[model samples]
Target: MQQSPVDGLDLVFYNVPHAEAPAELTFAIPSMKAYCGSEIVAHTLHNLYTLRGAKVRDTLKWVGYLDQALDHTQDTEIFFAQHHWPVWGNKNIQKFITVQRDSYKFIHDQTVRMINAGMNGAEIAEAIKFPETLDQELSIHGYYGTLKHNARAVYQYYMGWFDANPANLDSLPPTQVAKEYVELAGGENAMIKLAQKAYTQANYRWAAELLKHVLNYNPNNKQAKDLQIKTFSQLGYMAEASTWRNFYLTGAMELETGAPRKGVSTEMLLEMLEHTPIERFLESMAASLNADRAKDVDMVINLVFSDLNESYQISVKNSVMHFKAVPKAENVHTTLTLTKPFFLKMVTGQSGALDLMFSKETKIDGSRLDLRRFFSLIDKAPGTFPIVTRK
Candidate 1:
């Protein structure tokens, strides 16, 4: 929880009573909200690594570990995080983390238990809440992340993928649904006016939900777009979790335009990726390529990243893909040699296509023209559009 300089976050918005009214705006929350990026991202990577096995190399000694547990006997315990006030004593830190761990673990465990008892995911989220004492506790709070969403994540872990609903099987996409909702709830202008009222009354959460529909219905509606941005601004200003603030701001940016990829620092993700299946990563890579370039140019490119100890010969036939992770030195389009992290960096677009050309990091020798052509076929991973439905 030690805060870094990158941890500082803030969001600001105007305080108009309604879209029709003009009024002064100010900082929604009057405090500095900060957190450690390395810490949060490391934890996230670990969770994913543990939940779904990842692939890492023995030669590469480090993954994403940011901190080491200080010897309790030598280093005195007086603080927790850099931004927040601290408490002394190892007993205190132990007590603090005990409740923190139990809170998330409780929601996770109990929600799964309830799912086994036939309560759906949403039901468990509604019925479950952290103990009142824990609710009052600052560190274990919904300000950064919520118990509600996490509970649903737990239910999804144990239960079947769907909520057992036939209606959801063929439901319209969010944008389509939002358009219908806006028409039913009056109109674009009406929703904007109402959202402004909710925002002004310090009812940010509701404002967010309503304005989201408005923006989705009319993405170019500046009034609705501005209102949605302001809503996320307020939420970001109020958030204690740096991750939450980043997500909100990212969402706001996407609302103004279509989704854009903000590639993460690949160093850490690459380290954790070793535990991932070679075929899955290649599949994801194939999915990442720009398919339009290869619409009429279907071909196969076998890629072998030696340092990752992985091999995948990717074939694109009739727009259907087949990735096999077997050793083959056949007449292929490309034979690349690089470490896991750098190759992944290239795959995620964090590094440029020619950086490898100018640098000593990686090499691409065979059929360079067709290799580029084959790499052009895949698509990137979709946005915060739920990997699995929780909304």
Candidate 2:
């Protein structure tokens, strides 16, 4: 079972042979397709840019689905969705689908036109305004994905990440830039004074921006930190979009509670590894490598997942890690053979690598010292890193 796209309720699909259907009855709909009786209502303004996170959705593709839904469901009497009450009559269903469908189409088409006219993401996000009729429609309201974010996502999808500006191409990382800003603004006390004034003026955005620099410079600044919590709380309360509200309120809660207390558990890590493609998992490890620690290290290790019947070689060179899914190479620093579960446990800190080697859960050949050195260079990342405050 999976939730319908817009209404956010469970839908269950059942299989039926073609011979069982009446000549007039069909399951296929052009864009908004479904199986059996599980019809999806394009009732709500579906997430054009989902905040909880996923690939940026193609609003045009979604509109195409709606077009198909209109052609297929014309004769249907009742229109039901996951979250909201069903529309009982044919006319009402048509009205609901037509308005919702057109709203998405308008947004998609207008954003594309703006992009072709040489508008950037932020410009497009601010420029596109909904038609008065659609804007006033209760069904297609911005209760989830708002116009501001959806427009930006559309622009990014078409134009890519570069804003066609050279300044953004090689910008300093956030912490470095924040430190510079703090120094330029005459240190913590000066920033705190400015932020406190902004807070008083109800300019929460500026206050949060300034205080962030202060907090990044000194994570222990109680006054700056407390003001940020207040700013996030106010922003959370004022937000109409559910996702925006959740993000702000959650940030406040994290500040109050000292970040999320949970780390990736062994079971969770194992489940993730079990489902992930081996090549993708290896590629991800490059991102997780502690480059500073591994700067001078150059080694290669053969990994054999015996139970899964997979073999790969991992190479570390010039502070970068690379992997290929080929037969294990003979010349290597170490060769470790283990089941996928055992590997997950060892990596997630649930089981000691040396203990696993001794227990025969992991069979290691070649230099044990090389394996130890390699593991030492791997940084132990905290599960819950601070966001609003310094780590």
The TM-scores, one per candidate, come to 0.57, 0.78
Residue 65's C-alpha lDDT in candidate 2? 56
* Model 2: worst 10 consecutive residues (lDDT sum): 17-26
The lDDT per prediction is: 0.57, 0.74
Q: Model 2: what TM-score?
A: 0.78
Worst 10 residues of 1 by lDDT: 58-67
Q: Write the per-residue lDDT of candidate 2 for residues 321-349, one digit (tens) a residue.
A: 98888898899999988887777677667
Candidate 1, 174-269: lDDT as tens digits: 788888989988998888888989999989989988887876676668887777777887887787655667777766766666444554444566
Off by more than 4 A, model 2? 1-43, 52-54, 78-90, 116-119, 175-201, 261-273
Best by TM-score: 2
Leading candidate by lDDT: 2
- Predicted candidate 1, C-alpha RMSD: 13.8
